[model samples]
Target: MRRFERIHDIVEPVEGYRRGGYHPVHLHDIYNQRYEIIGKLSHGQFSTVWLAYDRLLQQHVALKTLKADASKNNKELSTLRHLSATNPDHPGKRHVLELLDYFEHDGPNGTHLCLVLPVMVSDGEGMTVNGKSHEATYVRSISKQILLGLDFLHTLSIVHCDLQPANIMVSTEAAAHSETFLQPPEFNPARWLKGMTADESAPNYLIATQRRRGQLDSADWSELSVKIGDLGGGGREGNHRKSVAPTALRVPELIHQNKTWNASIDAWALGCLICELATNEPLFPLGIFGLSAEQIDHEHLSLIGGLLDGDGQINETFVKHLTDRLPPDFGAENIQHLASFLGLMLQQDPLKRMSTVELLKHPFLVGDIEG
Candidate 1:
């Protein structure tokens, strides 16, 4: 019998794996006879997420599978464990995804690490019920929740390197009544490990992969809560990984490749995310330039570069007057307050950016503010 590898041995950002050439798990294929695959949720660079039903708990779950060979020392499992132990004190704060269970399974791709997570819905559910923009109140509420989640992570010195729209999911009341039918795989880890690693067993009718996509009803949007998902790019304060947020959401510090950055980088990302949520469009549509990576960096700097005065400290006057420079869409209602908040979050210098703890206390979080 082969022994399971130690958890600490796994590292973040495993390389060399791709979405193609991997083994396929059939419909109704159950692992340990505990989780039955209902549908494929999505695929990533090194793993595939499947929507499954928990036979023991009788609830829906998202199962993420990572090829064991490519998954050395999985950091996400450890991060979830640490977060669970830390336990944020806010009762209403359900902004982070909860890890229910995890185990190893052998497939045609060799051994795979499977993580059981709660299924998530879309975030834009109820905001546009009337077809007008999402009100400032709803935007404030969601932003507060995201800040609280960030505060929890920053308190523990963890940096969520990615915080894009895709990583933020919404949970709705309707999901409780949803149901699906699927068959379960027979329990036998040893047998599956010794099982064939070829793709010949795949059913002719089955597609190699399926994508799970969802949209929320406008009425349900108000009842929806946001949770930050996908911590695969996250790590302890100084892990030094390249390219944190998605291109459009990338902060100056990350774009500059400064290795000394800490949790404040997340502040920049949260700022960009909040702007998009408020405007229903990307804060910085860097793709419009369509330049190479180096040129794109310059374009980003040009937008926020003026925040830095000759002395290099944050120009209080510059950020204070940001409303004049920013477009009207950011504020829709309370322009001054929103512009000030974005200024604080989008500081050109990482050190000058507001910490999550400080950002949570800003006037913007409470209500509208004067410049």
Candidate 2:
């Protein structure tokens, strides 16, 4: 009933409230008379995620609603449905985010597709201790879990074209309770825009508040787990996507565009992520200080070349470079083994990158490197 003069800072872009953009959703709004919207989780370029309570299942779930235009040809929805139907018993499946449900909502804008997923504590980067880099053992655990997740998808001939820290998420456990679930904050329904009669294209009110569900800092690392999420850019193996990963995380094969890239791109990203986790810095920190997008790509490719030799193998000097970048607390032997392990995944040639199965068996992941 109350109206606001202007859009709030915390909510999504107001321009997105158009015919083909984000669906206007208010708190307590029920989709298909089932999932009750609780609060805002997050938003992206094409979709907004909301925390919702499923009446049928009586559990909290993340409801991702894609824009009207994005819903027309949604590959992520198709990929999720495919994953849900296949390999229900695989061990690696547990490491991947599960698609609980999906359906369409015809709003004022257009028909939007909503996906229901388990509520995670936070993104994969949350594994860091109190906003700092994680210990070597913790990083190893997170890396191993992510590898298992990739193994699950790759085994099914699926390629997560955009594997990064943000796509990897920490899973929630029943024992690790938090106020996010117990105390769902109630907000005053957003008012219609000032001086405007009920706009059919926009929601009557926008939920201006955002809330994160869980706390990872206090969680027991021994019991906590991570899952790979955000399959929007994913596709079947050998689909030949045109460089989907972030510039700094892009692999040489993707940058060169010489061959058909595949799931191995995820492996390459895992290698970069390992370095970031070990040192709290991106291995390829490009696009800084007024660098253009083209310049960033060029710099990234150059950095990759510097890490390899004429034979396309990781050069000895690069190994030392990795050692120097890694934390000294990792110990000399552990750093050496980690450097060797990363070398297997960070190959300039996609064919040379290690498969998740092989990576899972590596000495670093198999507990050879002491914590």
Q: Which number leads on TM-score?
A: 2
TM-score of each: 0.76, 0.86
Query: What tens-digit string does per-residue lDDT give for candidate 1 at 22-110?
Result: 34555688987899977755556666777788999998888887756545588888888777777558532467887889888766446
- What global local distance difference test value does model 2 have? 0.76
Residues 1-371, candidate 2: write the lDDT tens digits.
33345565666666677789889888788997899987777677788988888889788888999999999979898888888888888778988888988899998899999989988767755443334645668777877888888899999999888877778878558632332533454444445556866676766656543544335656666777788888888888877757578888888766665668778888888888877766667778786579876677788888877775535454677778867766667667777677778888888777888898999888888865565
Residue 145 of model 1 has an lDDT of 80
Tell me how far the alpha carbon of residue 110 in candidate 1 is from the true structure, in angstroms, after superposition: 1.4
Kindly report which residue stretches of model 2 are placed more than 4 angstroms away from their true locations once superposed.
1-11, 125-130, 175-198, 204-214, 288-293, 308-328
